[model samples]
Target chain A: MGMKLDEALVRARRALDKPAEFGPDLNVSEFAVVTGGNELALSRGRDRLSLVGVDLSDENRAGSYYQVDESVVGISAKMPGLTVLPFEHAIEEGIIENYVWELVPPDLDKYTALNAIYGRRGYVVVAERKRKIREPVQACLFMSSPGGIQVPHNVIIAEEGSELSVYTGCTIMPEVVGLHVGVTEIYVKHGAKVNFVMIHAWNEDAHVRPRTAVLVEEGGTYVEHYINMAPVASLQARPRVTLAGREAKAHLSSVIVAKGRSLMDFGGLIRLEGEETRGEIVSRVIAKDFARTTSRLRLEANGIGCRGHTECNGLMLSKRAQILTIPELLSSVSDAELTHEAAVGKLKEEEIYYLTARGIKRKEAISMLVRGFMNVRIEGLPSKLRRQIDLAIAMAAAGL
Target chain B: MRMTALYVRNLFVRSSGEKMILKNVSLELYSGERVLLLGPNGSGKSSLIQTIMGNPKYEVVSGEIYLNSERITDLPTEDRVSRGLGVIFQMSPVIRGISLRDLLVKVSKRSGVSLEDVRAVADELNATHLLDRSLNQGFSGGEMKKAELLLLFAQNPKIALIDEIDSGVDVDSLNSVGKVFQRLFSDENRTLLIVTHTGHIARYVGVNTAYVMINGRIVCKGDPKRILETIFKEGFNKCLECVGVGDEAR
Candidate 1:
């Protein structure tokens, strides 16, 4: 079960030379498959994780999953009616038989194909039927091996009438050159709810590609929040979610920070497919230094009485930095409502004057504004996790 | 001799667009004195206060400004603020991220006002709900004036330039704001330059001198009660006896 050479391997081989439709292409052969980690992961990994606001020792979390390179280092679940396990372990135990790549396919892209073949190290989270776990579950992936490739396939399932919350942080050690391709699929069954928060931090030498898809059934709610604050060489992610059942709802909020020569292309798409379903995609981006970002969010309404909205806002901090915001909305039914709004510009001078006139230094005023622009105020997050995210946003704003 | 807390002499001001907004304006605000600069719309009364506060939007093309006898014509807005200059713009722009509490703390740096002290002032002003919110974000007209007053209180400046503070405020809010003005006037160290078009604030706040501007020039200055009586009788009319003809405000 280590590696597959069947149709999965064939798909990986055929799409090995394929390039992503969005973001800069990464050379697949440029990185070595990380096979092991040195003593630093055993000794100082927690310290490095803490730098990005990842806390495993917090008792408020229902469970925690830690993965370094290609290995799953730690996994646990503290509450009943909840299951958290590594991808391989969950596969062996048959917990992800229906959720594994059911929403996201291998042929979607070269990265997904590679993930289906070499990405056996990730997390699996499942909430049993009618079980609403109050505490948030934590998952983290660490890419520390230099010039290495770390592929992870993550699956989350909230069974019928169940509720689950997860916070996933992907980070790397200082100055480590790595390529991380992560694939995730989330399933929200009837009357279930899922809150997923994924934050990534990396040095300037890393390139990341994350592929995710979510499906929300009838009377279910799916909320996703994504943030990438560290200076990465490049990051390209466009996760799509479908509201598949009547009265299903999905809200996707993304915070993107591009600095220090980083190139970030991030977007989200929400599809309202069922009657009376609703969806929204909101994104905020801060581009500084020589960084450049293209932020796009799209919403589609296909069923009667369904409505969707998409908004993309970007702030440019430097003359050399560039930001592009694209908002797309589509409605196939006459009764469906679709709207979009996009704005990409620098910090308003009136806002700066408002603070500077308050006796605050101009630089500090700009920093405060930058931090506020990055604040999305995600909904339905636990207090402990929300505090961690707030701290992380503050630290990221200060880093500039 | 009385100390001039804020002295502006022959100040010709222009906006960032190079349009002249203030022409040959001169005023003297003595310590412990609250003055009302009254005018109608487009009369440049707010421009005078903004020029004194060193808003980069309005540039002093010539002449000089002094605060507490120190030349501050060339200082930036932050420096002027640190020198005990406080102002509440007629319409404070929505600051997306900076909270009122954060701005209060930053502005109160020289005044040594702690966060608790700011909180206390917010409570007194009935603006505690705005303490944690982003400055001026989604605030009603009344809430905007109240929040600006809270910020001014946090600074506790020696000179306060309040523009149209009573315009959008309700009667209750005006009472609270008037109380804050009274507190400032109770001390001998504060100079007040309250700018208004309606001049209705005179009923709530006390002012020593009332200066009426027909266009960009101060045409008349006298006892607050007399000026009010004259203006209320005739409206913002041309007082050519004390001043000459002038152009419309920029």
Candidate 2:
């Protein structure tokens, strides 16, 4: 190996020895999770997990799969052409020999701490060129034990001309006090397409931070839809996508609900680095019951003929709730076009009256409006996944 | 004598800024009676209808409004709607992100009407094509009036307030709207209060009485045909002389 694993680990430790500061109000050094006396029963945890489309079972392992609970418990690939395994096993077998620690370096204190102390981490999915995976590769990273931290490193690669879909749900048992720091890296090669859907169903006492980055090559398309409608103590994530070759495209969307004094800071950035690259980012946030949420989207166009647009809208459902939206656009080349729009406000009274005047109750009217505000139509989603997302949105609206 | 359907007695209303908008307005309509409220611009015709519909913006400083002999001046707009009061505004606000189909479904569920009936009404208004679109979003004046009429038809309230439904509407839409009203008012238990400036709708629906309003006060009441013809040909100036108001009143 050009770089010894032990030496690379040491370097990562040195680089990320201290907790990184994100902003004035969101410094990680002051972040901590309080545990004990908050663990949920197994059945209850499984019930909560099912909300995100993860059904817990011990039957025969089917399709491409990875199920984690404190550690990687199950890994399989029923598909003949796909390769799936635990991270350490993949490393030992040389399947991950060339890519380990290369995409996500120990560049931040959170990552450094996780690398030094993580108990279970592994799962890499590779779809070779010309292969089209009809069934999605599903993974569930669940927290059943209280106060136990879960640090998972996931790497997904779609080789040239391949098409694949991935569905991942990360959830914690209700009242479980823990922290989850996951690092995900995805690569879409020439003429390949990758569709990724991630749902986070954390409890009110859980703190989550996910570091994700994607690179799309020539004629490649990457689409990502993320949802976090469950209550959480605090969440901070900023995922990025880079279009690095001609005609690369990326579309990123998120639907978030912050309730019950939760603090959420979420953002997405798309960088256009190649000629004729295009990108779009859209986010919808609903904050209620004293929850505080901040959503930001940044689009950067640096190449000729590049185009991008970013939209961030927030709805405040309570007087004590707060929402902050920041949409930014930057263009370096005169031919590159970039635009952004951001809005944050409570529901319009006129809309409420319009419904109530039709004899609908005031509460039902508000719920309908809130549901409509969060209903974002993402193109290219499978019918089943779309139905699951619709259910989650309806549940969130009802809870609010 | 016919039973009273809606009775507005000594009503005093104010705008949001506390300025009097409707002063000492009183009117009565019996069941199955169609009344035409005629006035020029800023004459408080809309304010009277809005106040009777329990709009909080038009504060009722005094007096009372009763729907079917049930006092509703203090009731909320929704409660008033539940008590058989429905209105079509002159200019309804656009409800963003709400589709016409969704609104109609909710109205159907609340008003005890079936979805099929709502669709039938929408089809009659030539608005079935607009059911999936956002409510009142980018709709022309005539379309807006038609949409409102669709909602009113679904609501099927005991007392219907049609505010300027004929204005800004095409001849065909006006005729269609008039036909629907004629069918609805054929029942002696239903009441109608139509507010208009042009009185062009008089050519379609039979109006039992016409009350001419000027400067927030009802100045004259007479037969609908005579009052509408006088106001249409000779202008409101001729009606002003019939009331004999002083400068302070103007």
**Cα error of candidate 2 at position A209, Å:** 0.8
List residue ranges in candidate 2 displaced over 4 A: A1-11, A21-44, A57-66, A75-104, A112-122, A125-137, A158-164, A189-193, A218-221, A245-248, A274-277, B124-126, B138-143, B166-189, B198-204, B244-250
DockQ of candidate 1 (2 decimals): 0.71
lDDT of 1 by residue, B104-204 (tens): 77767757867687787678788889877877888989889888888887788878898998898888888887776566457766778888877766666
What lDDT does candidate 1 reach at residue A3? 36
lDDT of 2 by residue, B1-250 (tens): 7899999998888999678988898888998888999989999999998888766677888999988888988887889898888888898887756777888777767778788877877777788887877788899999998888888887888888989989998888888877776775677677889999988766667778888888888877777777877887888877788653221222
TM-score of chain A of each: 0.95, 0.90
Considering every candidate listed, which one attains the maximal DockQ? 1
The local distance difference test score of model 2 is 0.78
lDDT of 1: 0.83
Which candidate should be chosen as best, given TM-score against the real structure? 1
lDDT tens digits, residues A1-400, model 2? 3354665666665654465444223233333332231224334567776777765562322344444455565566766567777666666777766665665565565554565345236478888887877667778777777676767777888899988777787887777677777877889999998888888889888888887889999999998989898889888887889999999999998999998888888989999999999999989998889899888788888879999988899988789999988788888899998988888898887777767777777888888889888777677776656776788778777767
Candidate 1: Cα lDDT at B232: 74
Error of 2 at B185 (Å): 5.8
